[model samples]
Target chain A: MTVTAPPARGAITAGEPIRLTSVNKTYTTATGPLPVLQDIDLHIETGEFVSLVGPSGCGKSTLLKIIAGLIPFDNGTVHVGEQAPKEGRRDVGFMLQQSVLMPWLSVRENVTLPFAIAREKGSHIAPRVEELLELVGLSHSADMNSWELSGGMQQRVALARTLALDPRVLLMDEPFAALDEFKREHLGLEVTKMHEDMGKTSILVTHSIPEAVMMSDRIIALGARPGRVVGDIRVDLPRPRSAAMIATPEFQDISRQVREALAGEDGSIS
Target chain B: MTTIQTPPQPAVVRAETVPHTKPKDPLLSRTWVKVGLPLLVLALGVGAWEVASQTGLVNPITVPPASDTFAAMIDLSTKDYFWHAAWITLQETLLGFLIGSTLGLVLGALTGTFAVFRTALWPFIVAIQNTPRVALAPVFLTWFGFGMTSKVVMAAVICFFPVVINTVAGLSSVDANARMLFRTYGATTSQTFFRLTLPTAAPVTFAGIKTALTLALLGAIVGEFVGASEGLGVLVNEFNFQLEVAMGFAVVVYLAVIGLILYALIEWLERRLITWSN
Candidate 1:
């Protein structure tokens, strides 16, 4: 599936783009320096849902973290919206693989945490909180704690929180990978809905072929043993992709293409 | 309500780590059981003791009958000296626990967040914490003189380490995911500490405070045993010196009551602060 760049602007990004140049990273594990991500260069246009799909040992998560500036990469430059990663991280919204909701806080409180931390108070804040909760179909559970909700709903809370900052560039490190297949597919669509409706530029790191193919505008497959970009396949699927899109011939074909690319590699790809 | 998709199974994130809802409560394990069982046992024990004393198996002067001790307690309650002494001990424990806990919390937070601070102070803290607090009573007396200051200081020093240790552990052990989430929000170190770290640390910190309350009582009593003009500890000493064992037992009962009240208060606050935890 070859998707030409859409003409419409993303809600948050508009024309803001993410660029990485000659990035190399090696993490100091217990034994020695483990080379994680090799020298890589990539560019993501504004408002694109890009998926970095790879096997377990691949540096897919490392790449996402570097882009979010949660971890530093050696000998490279990463720019999000014309700013280096460290500074760019401040503007980018990040979602981790786990549903990082504070169990102590209510759904509304968890979502509006960015506002609370910033001491942002306005008549507008409450309404926005309501809007985000409603967007995730969690308005009824706004007053409930995350622990009272299911895993999928917890992930939704985390998604709501990522959107709370209203950032242009969203860096998601396998946000729905922890959920069961049913929820993963369901939330995969929900996330696509989020990206399409909000028009925020998003980068999703996942090992799931069908998930990457169904949700993202482009799938960047990474090869293992020092992860590097091997395939960058643009998805031609239309906007507002739904669960129904999963069964489409085009979606399955692209998914198979991503799978073939992944399975073709020497390393194990699940 | 309109719903997109309901997650079929409600397996909340880390549900195994926390008890979200109350577990099944048998009729035997209800809140009323918690409140009633102790009182029932106490009454039964006291009745047996009183009966034994009445039956001439127990002596009043050596180990006072439960009735005599109860009578002494009632009699002491009317006396100005008992109230005054109780108030002094209460004051010492309250002031010392408050001051020590605050200092401990602040220091623990600093050390917990920064490796340098932990490394710098850990050896000294561990060395001091290891020495029994009882042995330090003499040093406290020599340094601060035989006044209430010495006693209060002793109480503070004794209870300090538990709060420090618990607060540090609690703050440092805040779930890694929560900390990462805070960082991705671009929260400042201080913001993360205050918002995420502090609230997350609260249940454990309250646990420390609860532990410290008992230690505070012990410290205050130990200080009074060493030297003090007033306190429940002093009163107990006076009763023992005068061979009024029943009155001594009564003073101990009063101390137990004070400990219970303080512990209950802290437990209540802990429940309030981290409702999701239990």
Candidate 2:
């Protein structure tokens, strides 16, 4: 309930005070209007790292998309910063499960894309590109295209691209789910560190319970079908979470709570 | 930016779904074996023809030996008139290719970008594309005369469709996630088109260009058939009048070799432009 704090005023402003009040979404299937989300309310404070974990058909991605202003909800007011998600989208960066890096462009060009779109061609953009690549640890492979890099490396490039615009709120949809466990844990640590460094609010939609516990300040677990927040727990394990922390009791306990929340009445789905 | 995960659970990543761009040795992949195999078949075909002609099994008048035709080609290359005619054909083919590809690319991009424009003009474009180029050649000749203009226009018009279809396809096949990433960043329509859509479509467009370039030569030849002062197509027709079958065969050989060279040039450009070229 503490995490359900009211969003600040305005639907359009900087990326702060992301608020979703009574959000509802229904997808029209061949059978009829199938409600995907119902009466969901959540609030994320500035620079807070939150993870939404749930079973399949929980509308977790839909929720992320709703927050991202990428899809229309049947009802409910969602606000990013003081403005609507649509109006304030410029300050919202997104990372998908797939690398989504343009294969034809070099790693350097892919990351620089948003910069070029947001601003005119200027000398300043080059340094920004370097800074981002350094942040993502992709400084060496800047000249190579996605085909030349491994999946994990390509995803890192995507992370760099998302940050290129310097959005205040980052919406991640299982960004590292496709990566192996070793990579998933490695990237999970790096991303959390990066999140702390940037002080940007992030909402990660993930299926991995441990990942949610490892990186999140708060973990929101949703039930199956018409997903509603089933469990909201504060991850007080500590900041700058390490790979070793995954083996600790506090991390295990937090992840267990998340898993239990994910395992709902529809137990088999998770 | 946020890619969809339909199922909340971990779906196993299929090994076959992802494309592997492992570069096999470029030279080794396109080995001499591949080249030699085709040459070996061609040799067998030509040798059989030569034997058939020499044994009087096939009439030399109707089906001249490959040797006679190749010798005619060598002899014709020495003639200033043949060179001038081949040069004219090449010029017409190239000019037509350039003009047609430009028109197709620009128009395709424009229509692809705007739904209203596509809806309004697509019918007309389809009609023009479907009209037989050979049927229209005589009309073009009447309007522009038997000069290179008619041939060039014909070549351009004939090759136009491939670029349009391929460019539009390339433009549409842009990864939805990439488009969403652009939209999430508030990229303008022009920005998305130029940055994401156009670049993604470039390789596909280049493929279309290759097809169009080859077709350009065919269009030029058809134009020459309508009426022309000089061209390889005209040379074939001239030889036909005198019943010089070997000479006609020689013109065809020159055309095929020219087409092969032009196709190779397109492949070379594709290697340079396409970042993920296999």
Candidate 3:
């Protein structure tokens, strides 16, 4: 696995390392205090693609949310680049399982939403929107309503929207979970290509082992029941990974390693 | 983020269910079934009324023949008095709806957005809404007088609650994921309300406005009925006293036509404003 040296402090850029130290999260439920994550220590280098794979009760999504600054952790220090994780940081883009596009807005308008919210003004915005749509292959459907697009196309539009502000750290939570095998694989390859082209630090949470192996430079296997880091296996596969790589011995070996790491805890890899 | 702790089961590919084909109704397929049927029912109703009146099956004093009613309508049309009354009622309904809906929208928006306003104002709004609006017509007449002002006030009062209720509901119905997305974008409270909440609430708010419009018409008529020198309701009362039952029926028909026109106008506006909803 290639690990880029950390940039100088206070130097924010397109790609930044994410560091989490002893992250602990507990949900105060009706029954009692339910611990979700315990002592999670992760260090993702600049421009590295990481995937968090685990069973059903694993706090993979929760951990991702913590890094995204969507929720607070009881005990931890999370750093996105040199700064503490903060909500609505222009440099951090968080994408969820569902597309969650505004039904009323057109595809172009949806992509331009972040700029509108920030009240950004410039001649550059229109061109940037067009470029993003082009990147997502939704240029033809720019004027169409979000609801008119298919599930896969909508997800692509969402990907475009997430990259609207050129966020450095892209956190995805089961983005392709709802898609079919064909679309899922197709989108996985597209995202890998985008990651390579843009060189943005990305972390994805998924249930599928092959998805994790196909996309990530390193697969962080997590265990359930007070989720903690179980295994951190580095993928020695070639860069610019394609669908054909999934059938290779190296890809299968890395997938087996991830599955074994997950199997050690609950033997319940869904 | 509800947790599912079920044991891992083998993935089951669901067989696509065959689409159920609905049997065609032969009679319903005809254009006559859609249009001619209602007209036929109406004709039969009018014919039955005429027969009953001619055969003295009911009191002619109260139940006038359809022909007599049409004659009364023609007679009323010739006079400027009926038109003036209708004009006054329309003005009252329009003004009242505008005022009431605006107030309701503002208050509802406040209540939905801010917890303090919701807690402080919600109970009072409910209490006032619960009080029958028609019952307040006499009080409105006493306060605003027997002119168009009183009827306008009555209509506004009647129109207020539905808008408030629907507005609150519409504002609350915003998707959770959308709210999270807005938060992630660092949107200000007002920005979120305007861009996300307002657009989300529009379809529901329009529904309330449509309902409130019809109620506004009813409110105006009721106010005129209680105490007014002009309006279609006043004409109906006068015709009753003079035993011109057919004339009262004619005035009712005019009110129905006005109601239909108002409803159609609202529907057209709804389609224009909420184009993406469809």
- Stretches of candidate 1 exceeding 4 Å from the true structure: A1-15, A28-32, A87-91, A118-121, A264-268, B1-25, B29-36, B268-278
TM-score (chain A only) of candidate 3 = 0.94
Model 3: residue B245 alpha-carbon error in angstroms = 1.7
Off by over 4 Å in 2: A1-15, A27-34, A72-75, A87-90, A120-125, A265-270, B1-45, B117-150, B226-229, B276-278
Stronger candidate by TM-score (1 vs 3): 3
Which lDDT values do the candidates have, in the order given?
0.80, 0.82, 0.87
- The predicted structure with the larger lDDT, 2 or 3, is 3
Which ten residues in a row are the worst by lDDT in model 2 chain B? B5-14
Please report how far candidate 3 places residue B124 from its true position, in Å.
4.2
Worst 10-residue lDDT window for candidate 3 chain A reads A1-10
Q: What tens digits encode model 2's per-residue C-alpha lDDT throughout A31-147?
A: 999888988999999989999988878899999998888889988898887777672255788999998887777899989877677674667678878988998998898998677
List the pairs of residues colliding in candidate 3: none
Against the true structure, whose TM-score is highest?
3
Shift in Å, residue B169, candidate 2: 0.8
| Chain A TM-score, prediction 2 | 0.91
